[model samples]
Target: MAAAPGLAPDAPLHIVSNAGSGSKDAHEARQQIEAILTAAHRPHEFILIDNPGELARVAKQAAEAAVRSDGAVVVAGGDGTINAVVQAVLPTERPFGIIPQGTFNYSSRAHGIPLDTREAANALLTARPKPVQVGMVNDRAFLVNASLGLYPELLQDREAYKRQYGRRRTVAMWAGLKTLLREHRQLIVEVEHEQGSETLFTPSIFVGNNALQLEQVGLEEAEDVKRHRLAAVIVEPVSTTELVWLGIRGMLGRLGDDERIRDFPFRSMTVRLLSSGKKRTIKVAVDGEIFWCEQPLTFHVAEHPLSLLTPTTVK
Candidate 1:
């Protein structure tokens, strides 16, 4: 197997595998990845991590090792795991790769990384390094998207529901519906962007770094990811019936036609909560991980682009 451009064939590859990812058999996934690397005659080291808290520490160590040896780090897990590793790898400017084993591999898919474990591993041999822009919320980096209001609430409830029941689409949908019906309070926020400043009364706000995912949800597709901009979709304040209708449209992939759903592009923005005496901190879901960040929250493109190894066919 040929190595990617600028990457030496003899250079070692460091792999961090999350054993608790959405994959049915993490052990099998790790074995398959190792087999592919071995067959290619690549020097590699693999580590399996089950706890999320330890991911940052392990990945940081791997990244440091990679820097000294001029190697790369491969993360085999879901978006959340990838996001965690990204936080550590971005600062080091090390070459990064991913094997999508998540329930929603939005980040990987957006970058054209193969979802199949074997295919993804094979692609790595010939993939090329590309600089992809990343989105930042406060101090953290998110590869896919982040949101507030009803969406965040829904995500929180979905995890609780999943814990009681099981990880299922039906359960997630039910949780979202329940959250929407129960949490009817609207948020009044002041949004300041490159365009201008505007006050909005909304129930939800979605900020996306991946245009393909946004397009799938009926928002306009971004012409370029390297533009270092975010695509935002804000749900305008509406009656519960209208909100339900908007949800139906989103589910049916017709949200683009819904007037209540506003879409725009921004290089940077500030979202300030107008509710008096509201908590200084609020929950923001970044790549499916919940984080409580101090408001007024700021969103912007990162200063440096991620050095990603993607399939040659992706470009």
Candidate 2:
């Protein structure tokens, strides 16, 4: 991949850290990051964000500052924070760096960024900027998967359940069960992609930009992330008992064997709600965060490539 032109070796760096990520205390993480940058003789500015709600604002400001100075922005947080930062920086020519501090760190992991903060920082110092494809739903950019129906509802319920009970597998499973029982509604949708159009009466639809993560769940087989296409999977509606069984199969990482799951790839896709009223809208989850988008929802590869600072060892 070709590198972006503006991010030179001596350009200044700006780092945005989310306070509530991972198991490490916010202060401790900041201290460690500062120490690593200092030891590397890299001059940088650090912005510590205490509230989740302020992340987008703070990141956008940092990205604007970085663009003005011909610098780069290093995001030190999980997927949600990274997603916000990516959106903020995508408009600029500035290169983006990542230090994974989230539970899954799917974006960083897919790009081969080291999970350890110190090591990730080292990779940042040594890595080169490479242009990578980004996926867009409506106008917002997402580096991971975007989905509607059961998955989004499950994500909403899981967060609420996690707050009340805890972040355990059992709690998550219970949350899934509760959500499915309460909010399991079928979607009657018309999907138009590069291949053709199809009418589907399914309970869920998932479109993936990070195909590796989809493969991890046995939903896809493609390993390439720079393909510049979206991988989509639709789950055929089934009885509640069968749905629970399917969920269990997903948990056991055997979803690929399930006959009801259909997978395909597309350069662009449009999903329209068949039962929609005059003003059509639906709640869709982009990289695990939920938002309402107007239908027919349009998805495609972003117009510009995202400049990413990734380890040279990562191919």
Candidate 3:
């Protein structure tokens, strides 16, 4: 087999460490990355980020450094970190890489980036930069998925519970149940897409870009992603108990068949909050990171694709 045309053996790698997470896992990832590249005699440097709040700024700096050094921009962390770095790297048109330290690792796994630390680092040596589609929400990159309403609320609620109860799997499950049992206000919106338009009253709007994540949830719309389109899912307004049951069904990977849920595929969409009253922005969870985005959130495939350093086996 012909060898993949990758970066020069001595090309610099500007690695952003802990830009998304400050957990011990990130620190260990840093250590492993350093060890692998050092053994291979590769040129690299780590932009160690001690403060998670500086993720966006640090990511920009890392990307700029890679551009100046004529190297690749690499990130070590979960979806959040990758999302941050992706936003920076996209404009530079630089080779982007990731070491999957995140739990789900949807984006990395989707592109054949290994989950194992050493293997992921070693693969970076020979992987070629491949143009990959990316989804953008209000001009911000979301490598995996973007969500609004109950999903972000559930994540916030779970974080609160983790502080009070514990961080065990059981605690997390209980927290999700507790969050679902409560009443959630529906989002009344005017959704416009390629298929046409409609007004929807739902607890959450989930737009998926990664096929692997969509498949894991048993949603057939995963196929939509392969066509360079985004997949959307919304649950009809329902009672709290019924909503809780729907959440359970989702966890069981059987939620797609339920009548309460509706999903479709589209190239682009404009969502206007018709019932938001005076609110100018809403909390949106993009690639597992939460932030407030202005009204009329637009979701679509980015005009330009990301140059991802993907393993040749994947191509």
Candidate 4:
């Protein structure tokens, strides 16, 4: 692990620590950060945002601070909290710095930030920030991919399932397989790709700006699987029996280059919850955080994206 990046001699920084949302050793990590800052002779302010609805407010304050001091806005939390700050943030004078302390911190991990708090903090302090694309669902910022149908359903029971199974959480995968077998629910997904408009009945759909390549896919490199286009994929099943087989296939990571599972690249995609009311309520999960919102959900790539400091050279 390295020390926190030295500020421009006597630079000011604003740190907003999300309360009750990080790993168990957050306090010790903060102490380490404070010690580093003190040793570097850098002046900083630490605000523990603990009140309800205070995250967004504090985020805005941090952004404003970044603008005023021309320094960095640093956040310590999990994926959801990170997503909240990313969404709330505006283009500022300084870049955003992150320390991953949440469950499934894939964004941080994907960017090559260390899972350990102190190591990641050190990397952020020293590394050069790189610009990366950010996705917007109806103008809501997201760091990773978004999903519909079975994903929302599966994630809905994630907490309950996690608690019940604990270390044996693979049970959720089995349960999802069972849901696929017993419940023959099909969603009417209308996708407007660069080619044209096509509607299909899918069990689930994923709108991805990037793809996590698995070994079953037979790829050594997990490069920019996503480009200016979004990947729309469906794991379609012919019947209830076939649905179970498909789930098993997906779980075993065996379904690769199959016709039933297709990926379409598009610059934009819109999803409408067909059965829902005027409110257009659909469960949308972005970067592992779930929320209920009505659709037609509009997703597009943001023009001016943030600079994510990562270990990789790829933008």
Candidate 3 local lDDT, 137-178, one digit each (tens): 998888788999888988788778877985555776778899
Please report, as a residue range, the 10-residue window in candidate 2 with the lowest summed lDDT: 219-228
Each prediction's Cα lDDT score? 0.83, 0.82, 0.85, 0.65
* Per-residue alpha-carbon lDDT of candidate 1 for residues 214-286, written as tens digits (9 for 90 to 100): 7676776465444668888899888877877777677777888788888888878999988736589887999
Clashes in predicted model 1: 0
- Best lDDT among the predictions, by candidate number: 3
Question: Candidate 4 at residue 206, lDDT?
Answer: 68
Q: Whole-model lDDT for model 1 versus the true structure?
A: 0.83
Best by TM-score: 3
Tens digit of lDDT per residue, candidate 4, span 85-167? 77655355256667787665667766677878777666655655556667777767777677877777766666567667742
Q: Is candidate 2 or candidate 3 better by TM-score?
A: 3
Where model 4 places Cα greater than 4 Å from the true spot, the runs are 1-11, 21-23, 163-184, 211-226, 237-255, 277-279, 311-315
Q: What shift in Å separates residue 146 of candidate 2 from its native position after superposition?
A: 0.6
Better of 2 and 4 by lDDT: 2
* Candidate 2 lDDT for residue 214: 74
Please list all clashing residue pairs in model 1, or write none if there are none: none
Clashes of each: 0, 0, 0, 5
**What are the models' TM-scores?**
0.91, 0.91, 0.92, 0.80
Give the poorly placed runs of model 2, Cα more than 4 Å off. Answer: 1-3, 19-24, 165-174, 181-183, 221-226
Worst 10 residues of 3 by lDDT: 1-10
